[model samples]
Target chain A: MDPDELEFLGEKSKIMIIPTFNKENIHLISGDLGPFRASLPSQVPLWVATLLKKQKRCKIIPPDWMNVEYLEALKEQEKQTSGFTRMPSDHYMVEAKLLLDCAPDDIPNADEVKVIIKDIWDMRMSKIRSSVTKLVKNSDFYAAVDNLTIMEINSVRPILPHALDNLFRMKHIEQPKPSQNSNVSSFLMSKRASTSFQLSNNEDY
Target chain B: MDLDDTNLEDLNDSNDSEDYVHITPAEVLELMEETWVNEKFAPEILPNKTEVVDIILEQIKSMEVNIKNLSNDDFTKNIYQLEVDKLRFMVTSYLRTRLEKIESYVVHILKEEEKRVEKGESKYLSEQEYKFAQDYSRSMDRYFNKIMNFCPNLTSDTWSSKVIEPNNNSFVFMKSKKTIEGLPIDITNADSDLVDIKSGSRVIICYSSIEELVKNGDVNLI
Candidate 1:
């Protein structure tokens, strides 16, 4: 599929409209939409819904996954699973966040949704952090776990590559060029200097 | 009678096959935002503006109706929603950019007026200018309040207070101009207070403290 199609799939949000004008079935590049009538809830692309909402023409309907009660239950399910639990939608978290930010009034219990999402994020991050540290300690660079979600893997990508590279360098210390080693040492020194500054500042607060 | 019929026929054809162009929210937002770049720096050079915002808003209204009857795969709908997010983001940013300009100018003026008052100057603003300033500030406040209400997460307290690890160390390379809060210092200085870092300087800063700075364009994560 084209990148446009891929991105379109990634961002769908559900919303409700109370239209003032009637329009027959309109053919769009993506698909067919509506014979719109007044006060009926129909699904539209999120962009259309948001635009309407901004104009006070429509109200957004929160998706089922956005409900605090549902999320809390899902979080419980996630907690019980040592393996990955299915999410309500592929992009529910991002979609819910966007809706909550843009049209909080349309989404019921938005503040609760935010809190629950954050709780889930924190739990996932903590798990990922521990696993990442363990991976580094074991120096199992080639190991790939099937359980990690794309988001989870991406969270560690920032530090993991560097950590693995460092491990590789340590294992093959015999043939290291002097100039390259110096360059890497200087970079490490700069990093150390910054950390020292941070350590000093920590005492003040 | 032939000419009148032809004209009537043309109108009917135009209405029957109204070619609706697909527009991404970003494109509409960018078109709306073009005027503000000049307005921020040179408000005087701005034209007697047309009410184009109303027109764009009307287009958005029509788009709402258009979306209602569509049945597409999940992907297309998501892409559409993403565009909406971008539209809202652009609108928020547009308002914020103007508000920033207004705030900085008003604050500078108010400060200058205060200094003048301290120096025993009688008048800061004339009656009309005073009224205009009051109205301007009120509108600025109103717009700001509206955005805060619309995006509750925009409030600093909502997001900023969640600092889990304050002392997590990270290196930061300064990107733009920033003044660190302290007296300038050299390495040989007996006191630690004299250090002043600038662009091209790499410093290890606590991750939590640098988070806001990185977001604000003052530093780059290294």
Candidate 2:
């Protein structure tokens, strides 16, 4: 799956926001949001919070783990550990990108927090890169990937999966067959065009 | 007065349809999401969730009606509209993914469907998709014969019999939904290697080793 698709799923997660206007409990198909009283914090879906912030109707309250001190400590612990550690949010990358992009001012020490998160992200990414290299070199049959979040897992996308697949296919060829006409379907081409168009549009956000 | 008196909760209680009497609309939405992700990541086509899609579409229509009752300037209208757009995109993407797979693997999937039908097993393709695959396969057969006519001297069973099939042996990232112990990944050795996957733990493994588990919802391809 694409990283944007992961972000789309991650946006379903709820976050706290302070609405500037009063409204009745907004009943959504997934669930109800709330009867918003001005200045009172209410938990809403991440997408909703971003939408409200974009409309200048709400102040986002950053999630607890998004703070500078917490992230710094977490970064230190991650450095100390040899294996992947659990992330505060399953889609931490998505949360950081969406929240920090729209409402940096709402988060105290936002710039510092952003830098620390990037530091942690880089640390974990390098660890993954080294592990992936080791995995492909040894041609291990399988590997446990317990604590890596979805976005981090996706970063190793086509390379890791394709390499492992090719290795397995090489080992398990059934029979030698003559070359045949295998043309790329035109249907897929058009579909891919539209999909990429949507991706580029979302990237602008 | 209608605006003040409207109660969205009432829609949840007044379910006249026996098809979805047991589960609430929210649960239906949740099931749709799970189905969408599972279908997206699985190496091959999965069983269609036609019932869930139908229910959600019905609910979307109902929601649209409710929204229409509100004035255009209502801020809540945009929120509701956003959700409807998301749901619409999800359903379209899910169905499109399946259709793409079907077209790509039409012959192989049809042959698999034949065996499943012979054994009285449930089918993976929906009724409309089956029709689509049949039509596509016929066209491919015609196209192949036309191509073979250009080279009539070839005497091999190569071009006539080859069909595109999904690589089941491909590696995929998966998260176990429950603790599944003693699962055999390899049985060639005298002391076979068994995997013990704790609930919520992720792994990168060959899809064929755990294809059945995935079908049974024990594990989800990330």
Candidate 3:
């Protein structure tokens, strides 16, 4: 999956935003948003907050975990742990990236927060790289991938799965009594993990 | 499609019930997003969710109509317009992803659809999709035969044999939606790893091992 697509999914997470304009609740199919009282903070999906922010209608209130100090501690723990440290949220990277991208000014010490988040991401990626190498070389059939976020998982995709699949094909369980025929299945899973559908010709709404 | 039958259904999914209950469009949108991501990741095509999709699309259309009635200078217009655009993006992306899979795995999908029919199972492909697959398969066959005329004995059978199929054995990182005792990891080994996968636990496992669970929505591939 493309990082943008993952970010799209991540945009669904509700976050606090202070709207400058007052309006009745905007009824949307996904959910309702704001009877915006000026300068009063309300929680809305990140996507909504982004558009409002872009239109200069709202100020994004960064999530509590987006703080530099908290992330620095998290990064320290991530480095100390041999295994992947559980992220603050399943879409932590996604939320961080989107929030940071759209409203850097809303966040305090935004620069420091950005640096620490990247550090955490880099550390996690290195861990995933080493772990993947170990998994591919080992005889273990599967590994528990606890704490890996969607973006991290997507990074290893088509490659990791296909590589393991090819290994499985070559091995084909040297022993007997396999329920199904390994020879019958794909020798190599297609490198193309189906392109993310193009949306360039989108109808203006 | 006229899409006039925009009536939404309640939680009671029993086949015999001829009833309609109030279900908010909000809930439907969330379900659609989940289905979209699941379809995007699953190695094989999933059961058709056209009914749910139709309902959501219907809601979007109605929303659009309402937005059109708003005064030109209304500030709320942009918000509604933006929401509609985003919803359309989500739905279209879901559909386009499915279509790509259908085109790539036409032969494989048709074959499995037949097997599923024999077992009296619900179809994975909708009627329109099934037709599309058949037509695609036929056209590919014709193209193959046309090319084969210059070759030394090639047939549709040969073409089918060479079709690139989705590898179900591929590993996927899945978040378990339910706790299953002794879930089988790989059965090739006599003492295959069989561990309890608790609800909300994430793991990397062979798709073939949890294919059934995936279809039943017990796990979501990340």
Candidate 4:
């Protein structure tokens, strides 16, 4: 199986739907989605549930993880524990964002849920930021982080990897003095362009 | 094996064959990673990653066979095995990371170009990015070919059609679930049969039919 598919397999979304017809079952490569009945809740992949909800064939039952109470507790646990706590799924943040954006009406206390999720997310992110800053300041070559979420890593993807690369370069090369060094670093950062046509002439690659 | 060659230059010259034949897998992996991370957006650096992977695999395989023929020197054999394992690990990690980016890039470019066109911006990729895209596409093609070579049963008409038909502006595919109207699409399952698609049922439709469905969250592109 594809790695993406494997990752997605755990990201099933619960949805309440009113089917046009009484379908027995649908066998998909991901798994079998079964015996859909009108006005009943069923578990389906996030992609499928989102589609059904959009077409008015079904309404989404916001997953348990999206509950404001649960999120608040999660945030508390995150604050108290030195280690990471479990999330409902690997792609929970992306899934939550998708559902909240598309079907806000379906989710209960949608605004509150959003705030709590954001709170937990920000708390986690701030912790990540501090650790990363420490690593940079101390010039640590390797630091093992336990249970860092995929979303957390992805959120910092644009900077962290490139920062590490720059750090690696800095370690080997002699310093060019402070002002010249700042210019070089800024030049390097600017090379990380979103598009090809925006390339600067001084880009090494 | 030469006792008289005491100079550093002579010592370095003795391992010339090992130097020529045995490129460090970590270096290859690093070069490939750089090509993926930096050169992917522009065609400035072209390290043939696909070819490098192939050469590494062949080298590892031959080394495995050679190690089997050595004397019962468990100490040396264990070290050789350890080095080979490290190389294998590096290659696996490198390929996994690169392929993930390649798959995402394929989807990204299609959607990105479409958005650019709709926004009345110049939709054409810079010659460098276009070249990089071509290289990536070719690498993907080669990767799939190698997979099919190893496991012919996995090769299906649909798989090839989906990957190779890059020029088709609109694609017909099945909807895994219901979706709304007016969003863009990613291509998938081009040659599959059209069936009566309901929620979680398959349907055959073009890209535009499901644009909104794709954007509004009714259907997946694949």
- The most accurate candidate by TM-score is 3
Cα displacement (Å) at residue B198, model 2: 0.4
**What DockQ do you compute for every candidate structure?**
0.04, 0.32, 0.34, 0.02
Residue-level lDDT of model 1, residues B69-99, one tens digit each, is: 4476333344345444544444444455444
- As for DockQ, the candidate ahead, 1 or 2, is 2
Best by DockQ: 3
TM-score per candidate: 0.38, 0.86, 0.88, 0.41
- lDDT by residue (B99-198, candidate 4, tens digit) is 4343445534645566877998653444444566668767777777777776756673324333211212222233345523322222232443333334
TM-score of each model's B chain?
0.31, 0.84, 0.88, 0.32
Q: Please list all clashing residue pairs in model 3, or write none if there are none.
A: none
Q: State residue A191's C-alpha deviation in candidate 4, in Å.
A: 5.9
Alpha-carbon RMSD, candidate 2: 8.0
Ordered from best to worst TM-score, the candidate numbers read 3, 2, 4, 1
List candidate 4 segments past 4 Å from native.
A1-21, A27-29, A174-205, B1-222
DockQ, model 2, C-alpha based: 0.32
> Model 4: what TM-score?
0.41
Per-structure clash totals for the candidates: 17, 0, 0, 9
Error of 1 at A124 (Å): 0.9
- Considering lDDT, where higher is better, how would the candidates rank from best to worst? 2, 3, 4, 1
Task: Write model 2 residue lDDT over B159-193, tens digit each, in one string.
Answer: 43544557566678889999989876543234657
